[model samples]
Target: MVRVTGNEASMVLVMGVTGSGKSRFVNLLRGGSVEEGDGLMSVTQECQIVRVKIGSELAYVVDTPGFDDTTRSDADIFEEITTFLATQYASGLALKGITFLHRITDVRMQGSTLSTMTMFKELCGDHALKSVVLLTTFWDKLSDKSIGARRQQELRQEFWLDMTAKGSQVRRFDGSRDMAEALVMRLVDRPPVVLQIQRDIMQQGKRLEDTGVGRKIATRLDRSLEEKDKELEDLEKQISKASKRRSSRDLKQLEERLGRKLTERERIYASRQKLKASLGPEINAKVEKQQKSSPIMDKIQFFASILGMTVSVTTNIVLPLLGVAF
Candidate 1:
């Protein structure tokens, strides 16, 4: 187990799209057995915190679910994350920095990738961007290093320009425990910062939907609902024509399309509902859930016992089972 001697340890948050190597990165750091997601599916559905010994200080490294999660809505993911951040901030635990992972092998940034980046920016805001690191992963998977280098430059110049200009860094995460620790140590000395979303909810007394990241997600959902509605309309027209013509094959295809569209619409509506619901009750319920089964409580209580701090389940942040020491 990592030893702590200070009033608080530095905390770092790792964020990225699903399959961007978040769990793998945390596992590398602590020699922990956090389950890594296959490149297509996400395994770290909730925030997973691990204790790591960086030089002499211990930092709590948190792994978060990405925006385009395979099984959960973005709204749900955002709410869960908000619970973690709000708890930590209210407990007086500011983060030293945040690391955003990305796959170096992706040829270009997709719409989903751009949207995730936008959310990250909004969550951090301008001032906190200085503490952000854009860590690119999967370099070893690239066949031609030159192509990857060019893509990296494109990210800094185009897609990630705003963040880079605002003091966010772009670095490559070579697949090694040493590199991961190095990334964490880079921000250990910088004064801890309260993220924009944390301030919005905790200090400014803003509702979840009123925050910057919240507004971005809401806008995206609105556009997606509109697009899906249009697609449903188009499918309805095609189905109508197919029915009038009595073409069995086309009618079957159109009907199947309509069914898929309806299912998607239902999911979109559900996500919207989650966004509209109150956050206080959800967070309180999550706290209750963690009280019964979360290993994070064990770790936090352990910290409290050693550090002489007052740690309680009410502010218990979600932590997955993690091995101790690096």
Candidate 2:
């Protein structure tokens, strides 16, 4: 979840072992095309930083080489992550947090994966408190029970319990279209003020996010305003005619009453318009800003962008290269 705004920027790292579906998850989150690969096999030999937009914010999702690569030693992997973080921070990018992505299909958590997580935590220092553990690739296989329950049980027996006891947030995510909404809700701690307005509208049997009532109200209001204006114009004409005739004072009084009613209606319409103008964007901005600080949101945004870009790059460039060579 990379949200970039003119106000501030945050960077997140998506990390996992080879074949843990890091690239797939990234592409899914990003709404991008999927690439063909079995882990870290790619044209990209080193770590890469991909930029993505989330609402009014800019987010950078850094994808590092897989931690459990057979060719790369544990020390080398650790150094690679450390170097990336150091370079980013030195370049004045704010280091917000890391998402430790694990494949739900992968029943075994290797030692190298654990080591990678530990190294990230140590490198981040106090900021590690902001870290989120995202269990990715969850929808790979369906089961009556939770996938890899035995492995999850083992993790709970070992790491999960400890992390929970220490107040770390852990969430399970299956990369899908609804991922953004899910991530946004999880990350945004404060309710949007516009939600109150929506609630009010809902009580009147309407929903703000729903197109039906809002559109109906808008149409009706426009017609009503036009009709009222016409009525006011007619009343003025009647008043003028009555004054010229010098026969009926009652018609003049009726015209005055209609004039007052029209003024009141216009005032109410103006007030509603003012309320809509004031609350809509203000609430949206608040909701979006709060989302940027969310670990889950950050993870979703980063992975989504990376996955899309990776797939596009692979399809357009890598696949063509292979075709040319073969």
lDDT of 1 by residue, 1-326 (tens): 22323445778899989899998988887554477866668888777677776666667778889989989988989988887776666444558999999999998888888889888888888999989899889999988999989999988999888888888888877887767777777677689898888777767767777887787778878899999999999999998999999999999998998999999999888887666645545444444554455434344444333223342111112222222111
* Candidate 1 stretches greater than 4 Å from native: 1-7, 223-264, 277-326
Consecutive 10-residue window with the lowest summed lDDT within model 2: 317-326
Predicted structure 2, TM vs. truth: 0.49
User: lDDT of model 1 at residue 179?
Assistant: 73
Pairs in clash, predicted candidate 1: none
TM-score of each: 0.76, 0.49
The numbered model that scores best in TM-score is 1
lDDT of 2 by residue, 62-177 (tens): 66666556664333444344334433432234555445666666657667567655544444333244445445455556474355666666665676665545444555555553
In candidate 2 the C-alpha lDDT for residue 200 amounts to 27
Error of 1 at 316 (Å): 24
Local accuracy by lDDT, each model: 0.76, 0.47
